[model samples]
Target: MEREESNNNNKQHFSHKHILTRLQLDEVEEITCNACECDVEEEQFYGCTDCKYFLHEECAEAPRSIEHRSHPSHPLTLHAAATYSNQSFICDACGYVGYGFCYSCAHCSFDLHLFCSTLPHTIPKEEEHPHEIQLVCEQEKLLTSDMISICSFCDAMNTECWIYYCETCNFGFHLNCMISKVVEEEEEEEEE
Candidate 1:
């Protein structure tokens, strides 16, 4: 476990056969993290520049397994990437295709992206929705409509992912949409 602060050239990560060196990107290219299979969004990450193998810092630190609320019957094990014959998986939480680090239950075929696995069970009521929103996962159906429904927050349709929903308000949005935005307050009142 090499600390990011050290900037040592021989960081030992379990994912790769070669030693990863710390790197900072001044101008990022079309690089993707081998671990998460997502575009390299971080300016600083560990990489084997020679192999073009990279990992987002968070991905490098992910636990090997976790007890997730979504799949309560069994603990999900983390894999560096999809191990299915197809080498791909549809994230149960986001309803999107993924080819990177994922938490899965092999018996149930349930899969979740490393990022999606961390979403809170509930996002408290907000002024925009006026009611508490709870994360829902089950048979693929949106409660808002019998037919496909567009996300209230994002213009996309419910594409078979878990959602933050408010049945009373008949409101729902994808986990990606809810998380991509700044949903938390940023300021506090200052009394002089």
Candidate 2:
């Protein structure tokens, strides 16, 4: 059985070919979003029951283009896939490879993962530091050595992933590490 629900303020009408509906999950299912190719493991999602197209609630509601703080020079546009190839894209925010949706700048070839595009501009200062951690896009020309830089949290070499840096402390964090930290902090606050 199926049910139709009214579109909320967040939902945008993409096309008439697909009638998107909100889906309620009763149990865990391995459903992937058609837009970002990420797992729809959340309790609710928007989907096209007829075409089997699905999107995470956030992805479905994301603006067509946004002026991200990280890349202030130009606005990033949300795209189903890379314009040039069907191949995976390297996320400029996290530095990881992704096959799904991306927020990209056509002029600079800069791309960020759909979720990464939503990361906050700054993070609260950790106990070890006195200043707020700022999310930055490292410049390729700034690399003085061919060696990889180690992430302060994961202790992994940052060969291609995005990084969080503190200029005063000369400290750096992997984008994934920062994302996890933010999530953990939010969860902790929710519990209190």
Candidate 3:
């Protein structure tokens, strides 16, 4: 049952082809995160045999800095994992528990999703929404303490989840929410 559950979880996490491919292991490649203990497949998350720069796939995609579409005023920069004063971060993506790799606007103290920070400046119209997304910076003065926007993909308020949006067409979606939804749908189909 344990093996069965593990197989099921792997299927739920990644497409069969993605997960089934044999891992490319090398003696030179160093193990990065022991906490997650996830294996490397085609492309490594972040690593170099010579230097010590390494991160999880989740971490590599994390925004060192970004301009969010919804809260465009100032650029959201990635802050190293640290304890926050009053507000703490919780990634709606992957449901990982930690307090680093957060997106913040130095000008307005705006918080955001790390995955949202990694969103492509221009999204494919064929994916879901039919529009090109350009990064938008929020002006410090215009930003309110509260976030007021809805995710076009999940149809949820964009409070904790940051988003990608096309201003001309008004198309928007949460970065991680969209990925999760697709993965969930695939798993549901497999179960059926």
Candidate 4:
């Protein structure tokens, strides 16, 4: 292999010593991120274009370690990709089977998606609701196993996901439905 270097700040200092260039992928069908093992769609990602080694920009810059609030028992370590035989892990925060860019607690075998692990504690009332809403990812503490959670924002019921809530007034939103703070009408506007 030939040694190469670059002066780009965003793609600098990676665990692997490879020359990665920032790219805006076009209408790609099935390009996958080597780090996270997820599909690399038409978005800004970092990779060696010639080698076909790709990484989501978020995955490329994910912190090596984090002190996440949801799992205070131990600090989670960022893994470039799952090392399991099945090549995936169930996300503890959202209860979804995820591939790529997982934060794992080796001691407990608990894992989380990079996006789910970083949800903010509270959304201000000014964003989209009357009262401040808090994200609730540790669902076992608040919800009964038999009951399903419903997103007040979209009226979608889900058994495996986190919710954002305003404790004062009981407003709720699923992380998936409101992660971008996008409402249904906004989606409709884009289709017009």
Candidate 5:
């Protein structure tokens, strides 16, 4: 009886291990890298686990999506990178390369970063300016060329993307730049 119980315990443990490995694999999907254009198996970043869907970790964690949050009274959606006609924009999130993923108020020209749009009214920064950044309008201050100016957000200069103004200061950022910060944080934590 003792031997049987030990054997059964081992079997159950093995089963559990197998299930865990499968779960990890399930979180991964086949995707082509935008940079290398090579096929690679990438893990899903942020998405619905129940659906038969997954995005590349980069795609999933994209600071902006087609969905809109309730803070704004308008709906925002994602657009292909090529669709943008304006210039001098940046993602206020990861500082990546895009004017694609953005949150916009359909009723107005109010645009925000996928990440910045979701930030609370105040943020605690360890560096740079002391005061927390808040959202403000830059439409009037924006030069016709400003529309094409390189946004401090998303870090990429010359790309057309959603723009946001800091209420605390006249600072501007792109959506992707903000998302870059999140990615950097995650990477640093992993290194530790």
Candidate 6:
């Protein structure tokens, strides 16, 4: 009986009781991650059929606190809801306004999107570039002129999107551009 009890305990400890379960496409009706607020139609996701809680597998597994290079002064804590009265948050990393799960610093009022928080520190240099591109967090200060900061990769004016910048070369890239570039590279590698 003691051996059986021990086995049960082990199973309980190893089981994904708290983890979300993957659902079939047919099973995914209109569920979305409470964390990132992204719909299941975009990607495969995990969810609770009973409680109706859902999360992107990545969002569900995000670290409770992270020591991001962008906010080196203190570690940012993951928050399911904003503690402030504004009911919204603007990402310091990407410059986009959102109302969802965020990595936040209460002391500094710094916020980052889940996807922005998980961005890689460095990316391989594009064929046109001579050095590896480094990610830098730049705060968008109010400009008096109508001019806009342009993305080094796409040559488009940076508006609400997050930017990855290299201090050494003064190069910048929009978050979407970087993500797409990485995806394209991965697809090319898979083909090769």
TM-scores for all predictions:
0.73, 0.70, 0.44, 0.70, 0.34, 0.63
C-alpha lDDT values of all predictions: 0.75, 0.72, 0.47, 0.71, 0.40, 0.66
Q: Output the worst ten-in-a-row residue range by lDDT, candidate 4.
A: 1-10
- Tell me, by TM-score, which candidate is best: 1
Off by over 4 Å in 1: 1-6, 28-30, 125-127, 138-160, 176-192
Best by lDDT: 1
- Per-residue lDDT for 1-192 in model 1, tens only? 222433564578877889887777646376789877777867788888767898888888899989887778889999877879998998888777888888999889999998889877788876766788877765445554464356777877765767777777667787767655543321222221
Candidate 4 residue pairs in backbone clash? 36-100
Per-residue CA lDDT of candidate 5, range 62-160, in tens?
443444443245556543232346732344333343343455544554454444545554445548766665433233334343343355654445334
| lDDT string, candidate 6, 1-192, tens digits | 000111121111111355455644444367667787766554455555566666665676677889987778999998876667987898776666767789899899989888788777787777877778766554433122233447866898755565665556767788777767877997899799
TM-score of 6: 0.63
TM match of model 5 to true structure: 0.34
Question: What RMSD does each model have against the real structure?
Answer: 7.1, 5.2, 11.1, 5.3, 12.0, 8.2
Tens digits of per-residue lDDT, candidate 4, 1-192, equal 332333353465354567777766666345788765557764567777577677777778778999887778899998866657897998877666777678999898889887777778888888556888777776573466433356775687764677777777656767777744554666689799
TM-score of candidate 4 versus the correct structure, residues matched by position:
0.70
Using lDDT, rank the candidates from best to worst: 1, 2, 4, 6, 3, 5
> Model 5, 167: alpha-carbon shift in Å?
7.6
- The digit string of per-residue lDDT tens for model 2 on 39-115 reads 67787788776777778887887788998766788999988776756667888777677877788899999898888
